[model samples]
Target: MATFGVLVFPGSNCDHDAYHALKHVMNSEVKFLWHKDTDLSGIDFLIVPGGFSYGDYLRSGAIARFSPVMQEVVRFAEKGGPVMGICNGFQILLEAGLIPGAMMHNEKLQFVCKNVYIRTESTDSIYTSGLEKGQILDIPVSHGEGNYFIEQDGLKSLQDNDQILFRYCNEQGELTEEANFNGSVDHIAGIVNKQRNVLGMMPHPERAMEKLLGSEDGKPIFESILNSLSVA
Candidate 1:
């Protein structure tokens, strides 16, 4: 089994949720990596879960970016280690420069919490390897600042490199303005780094691991990561 490390920050409420999903639901070994911890020994994968790190002070993830463990996370990612950031974690990745683009307040200027549909834009990354491109996942997104923005050139690069992994979509997997829950550019919901080893997304895949919790669409993401490492 692949070993997973879930980072825990002071305001990281979803760390436990990620732990439960990987350790219990997915039946994988899981550990908690404290924010102050700089070591990542024996960890096969790292997950930065959703929550207001540093209480979202001075902007979401702005303070948490300098956490002791984050330094290691950046290094780990640079070395081609698999890393994922969800919701507030996504913000942290942006601040860490591990992922491209910036997150802005939802265009509606309000906090959003609800289930949404997202279509897999590419399966080239380990995170989406177990799924087919264009697959639609029913996941929940809860955040105040999830509107992803980037310069036109960066957008072109993402498009050219197939870095876009997921995009908000309607139930039928259609990209529509009404389905753009957060007004993200190109309805983007998730993306991978240039190396495709790091990913940042706003949806709570951990919260969707169980069908009883709403949907099991998130399970494939974990399975894909585990399966990829096992192959390697």
Candidate 2:
């Protein structure tokens, strides 16, 4: 069985949500890895979950980037280990330079907390391998700074390498400006690293893992990781 690790920082509130989703919902072995730990031994998949780490001081993930465990997370991702960052976790990945682009305050300057539709852009990575292109998913996003930004050159690189994983879209799976909740560049909702092993997104998949929450679309994201490990 694949062992999953969810990193826990001082201000992390969603760590347990991720733990429950992976441990009980997905039946995977899961553990909370403290921020001070340096070892990532026996962890096959790592998650940097959402929250206002370090009280979001200076910036959303600026302080959390220097956490002791992040060094190991960086080293693990450098070796192509599967790592996922959601919401503020995405901010951390950007701050740590594990993925491209930066996050900024929402265009509307308000915290967005609602279900948004996203279209799958690529299934070539472990996180989306079980999803089909253009499939619409109802995922909830709650954040004050979720706007994703990148330079033109880097944007071209991402497009050229097919690193984009999801885009904001309508319920019918049509991309539209009105569907952009936080004004991310090119309506991007999620993206993977060049190696396709690391993924960062602002939506909360762990919040949508069950039907009782209104949607189960998030299951395939975790399911994909489990499926990949079983095959390996």
Candidate 3:
């Protein structure tokens, strides 16, 4: 079985959520990599789970990006290992320059926590290998600074390279402004790195692993990771 590592920052509240989703729900091997640790020995896949890391000080992920383990994470991703960052984890990836784009406060300048629909824009990344193009997923997003922005050139680059993976959309899978709760540029909710081994997204797939909690749309994302690794 492939072993997954969930990074734990000082204030990472979602580490356990990722762990439970992977270990209990998916029946996969999961381990926690503390912020202070520099070694990443046995982890096959790495997840930078969400939460107010470092109390979201200075910036959402500014402090957490400087964590000791991030060095290894950067190295891991550079070596083509799969690394996924969700919500605050996404912020960290931005702060660490793992992916292009900057995060801003919600368009309403308020903390938004609710279920939202996102359309799968691309299935070229490791996390979405099992999903189909234009698939609509019901996932929950809870963040104040989830708005994603990029310069015109950067946006064009992402578009040209097929890096954009998920876009906020209506239940009917329409990319309407009403579905853009965070007002991210082009309704982008998730994106992958140039190599496609790293993914950064605002939605919390870990929170949507079970139908009892809300939706099971998040299961396929995990399954995709496992399936991709097995194929490799």
The list of candidate 2 runs beyond 4 A from truth reads none
RMSD of each: 0.6, 0.7, 0.6
lDDT of 2 at 107: 94
Kindly list the per-residue Cα lDDT of model 3 for residues 76-187, writing each as its tens digit.
9999998999999999999999999999999999899999999999988888989999999999999999999999999999999999999999999998999998889999
lDDT at 136, model 3: 98
| lDDT for each residue of candidate 1 in 1-232, tens digit (9 for 90 to 100) | 6799999999999999999999899899999999999999999999999998889999899999999999999999999999999999999999999999999999998899999999999999999999998999999999999999999999999999999999999999999999997899999999999999999999999999998878999999989988898998
TM-score, model 1 to reference: 0.99
Worst 10 residues of 1 by lDDT: 208-217
lDDT of 1 at 118: 97
Worst 10 residues of 3 by lDDT: 121-130
lDDT of 2 by residue, 1-232 (tens): 9999999999998999999999889999999999999999999999999999999999999999999999999999999899999998999999999999999999999999999999999989888999998889999999999999999999999999999999999899888888997889999999999989999999999999999978888999999999998997
Comparison by lDDT, 2 against 3, better one = 3
lDDT of model 3, residue 190: 96
